[model samples]
Target: MESLEHLTPTDREILNKSWAIVSKDMQQVAVNIFQMIFEQAPDAKLMFSFMMKDYNVTDQDTKTRIVT
Candidate 1:
């Protein structure tokens, strides 16, 4: 995976702002994936449920402690 260290200050600022928007889109995609899994394989719903729960928890913690 690539890192953002190579980005210039302006580029990093733009990327940060863009990421705020992209994160919401990604959350929707995550929910869609979870719904698909739930409909297609009921047994796998637990995995998706746990995964999404952890993601939300971590995101909230990070937003509160670091992002702000």
Candidate 2:
């Protein structure tokens, strides 16, 4: 799954369906992942300066925009 080139047709379909089901929560999931990454390496947040300023990064709305 880490390599898109290696994904089988069935694997892709499963992933597609799973994404459809989880898409609504994608923003929160992205935000949580980003938070975890930033917590592990505080400086990593600085790399995404553009992402923060254009959207309300502290909330899911920005995350949704970024993800979509």
Candidate 3:
């Protein structure tokens, strides 16, 4: 905790930049994971009643679910 308080401005900037890069990579990885899940187990898509469907039936939310 004490060492963190002594971090220079440059150190903070580098840490923040590194975090941003890693976060962006993680986002794409998550999307790929979801795509794989649906592809491998096509029937698993029915488990989620939240995803948007074609022009029929009831649920009308036209947005794919994304984990934040």
Candidate 4:
């Protein structure tokens, strides 16, 4: 089980940027993160899910009304 403590400074900066951009739609962010993690470490999917479950993040709704 890899911990976030091992992230390099650049990695942390990128994560911070991602968090800032996706803060409003965290569920979507989680989904993206899950995919990324799976691609990087296929065995870590379950761990990611377990860690994220407590956050109450919901799946992104397909239908969203956007105003221009």
Model 3 scores worst on lDDT over the 10 consecutive residues at 51-60
lDDT score for candidate 2 against the true structure: 0.73
Report the alpha-carbon TM-score of model 2 versus the true structure. Answer: 0.51
**What's the true lDDT of residue 26 in model 4?**
86
Clashing pairs in 3: none
Off-target runs (Cα >4 Å) in candidate 3 are 1-24, 52-68
Error of 1 at 41 (Å): 0.2
For residues 1-68, could you state the per-residue lDDT of candidate 3 as single tens digits?
99989999999999999888868789787888889998898657667777526213343497544331
Model 2, 1-68: lDDT tens per residue?
A: 36987999998999999998879798998998999997898657557876566444344655533321
C-alpha-based local distance difference test score of model 4: 0.69
lDDT per model vs. reference = 0.65, 0.73, 0.73, 0.69
lDDT of 4 at 64: 32
Model 3 CA lDDT for position 67? 31
lDDT of 4 by residue, 1-68 (tens): 38888999999999999878889898988889878987898546445556554344334576433221
Report model 4's TM-score to 2 decimal places.
Answer: 0.37
Q: Give one digit per residue, the lDDT tens place, for model 1 in 1-68.
A: 36777778999999889888878789787788778986797546345445454332334645632121
Error of 3 at 67 (Å): 26
